[model samples]
Target: MKIIIGSLNPTKVGAVKKVFNQYKVEGLNVPSNVSNQPLTDQETMQGAINRAYNARIAGESEIGIGLEGGVIIENDRLFLCNWGALVYENEVILASGAKILLPSEFINELRNGTELSVLMEQYTNEKDIRSKEGAVGVFTNGRITRTEIFEHICELLFGQYEFKKRKEENN
Candidate 1:
């Protein structure tokens, strides 16, 4: 099986490779067609779906994966959100990772129009933080790296596909 990922970011690409070890996987830059910082779950999921389909079309592969990280405010508290999508032909499956409340300091910066990636880089003083451990890694203190987070979501997405396939076969 051939799999294509929407973003060339190491974190995302690494997650796909780790999850679909049996498949040939490649990552390419693809547009999400969403805000730099998606503030809602709907926008975040749409971004993932968009990237999945676009990457499938671009790579001409059997499966395409898209991972998107965003933030949402609930009860005036900001939470880190990550979503993943898998695209096969006209079908799509999605799964989201655990959400954690972000620090108030980071929320202030996010409210000030700074993207999460930019805020993370500034907070960590590391260039290309997204390519490495990402905000998930920082918040979890490396307990759960970004690649692992996305890999879990990818597994969930693929599991859903497998369940659907089995159901269809039984029917």
Candidate 2:
């Protein structure tokens, strides 16, 4: 199986590779066609779906994977949200990963139009934070990494696909 990942970010690519180890995975840099900083769940999910569809079409692969990270405000608190999508043929499978409430410091910066990756870099004093541990890693103190988050999402997506396939076969 040939799988194309929408983003060249190491974490996103690594998650797809890890989840679908038997497949040939290619990471392509594709635009998500959404805002740099998605402020709602709907926008975040759309970004993932767009990337997955675009990558699959561009790579001419059997499957495409997209992972998007965004922030959402709930009850006057900001939370980090991540979404992933798997596109195959005309079907799309979606899943959401863990959500963590961001500290006021991060939220303040995010409200000022700073992207999460930028805020992470500033908070961790590290360059290219997205390629590394990412915001989840920083907040979780390495207990959970961005790759792990996306991996879980992929697992859920794959599970859903398998379940649907099996149901169809049974029917």
Candidate 3:
């Protein structure tokens, strides 16, 4: 199947391609000029949906995927969260992360409208928003990059394919 990923982040593209390659899914990167304006959990998912929908309208691919992330506050705590969406032949699959906690100060900063990327930049001093190597980098460590966060979200949305394959083998 021809799948288009809606983002220009290299880490996200690479991670999605790595997993999709195992299933023999031909993946293509479709960069979106859309704004990265995700301030809340709902808005984050909206960003992904917008990207995926835009990609589908812009291409002939059989599938389009979008990944978006943001920080959300709950129970007096700040959490790093993500959402993913898949659009294919009129079907849409969406999924999100289970809240991951952040530092108290970071939490306060985020609630003030500071984007996660900027927070990461000031905390890590790396100045690269896609590396996931700064403050939040600890979550991914060396196992995955920041860009992979979106890829991971996509995996959560599409991972059922692997589960189905496993079930078929047992049958």
Q: List the residue pairs that clash in candidate 3.
A: none
Local distance difference test values of all predictions, in order: 0.89, 0.89, 0.65
Q: For candidate 3, give the lDDT.
A: 0.65
Compared with the true structure, model 2 gives a TM-score of: 0.94
Per-candidate Cα RMSD to the true structure, in Å, reads 1.3, 1.3, 4.2
Cα lDDT of model 1 overall? 0.89
The superposed Cα distance between candidate 3 and the true structure at residue 51, in angstroms, equals 1.3
Residue-wise C-alpha lDDT for candidate 1, range 1-171, written one tens digit per residue? 889999999889998888888889999999999988988888899999989998999999999888999999777788888999999967899999999888767776777789999988888889887888888889889998888889999899889988988998999
Which residue runs does candidate 1 get wrong by more than 4 Å?
Answer: none
Which lDDT value does model 3 have at 12? 59
* Model 3 misplacement above 4 A: 22-37, 132-135, 139-148, 161-171
TM values, all candidates:
0.94, 0.94, 0.74
Candidate 1 positional error at 149, Å: 0.4
- Cα lDDT tens digits, model 2, 1-171, are 899999999999999899888889999999999989988888899999999999999999999888999989777788889999999978999999989888766666776788988877777789997888888888899999989999999899889878988998999
Quote the positional error of residue 32 for candidate 3 in Å: 7.7
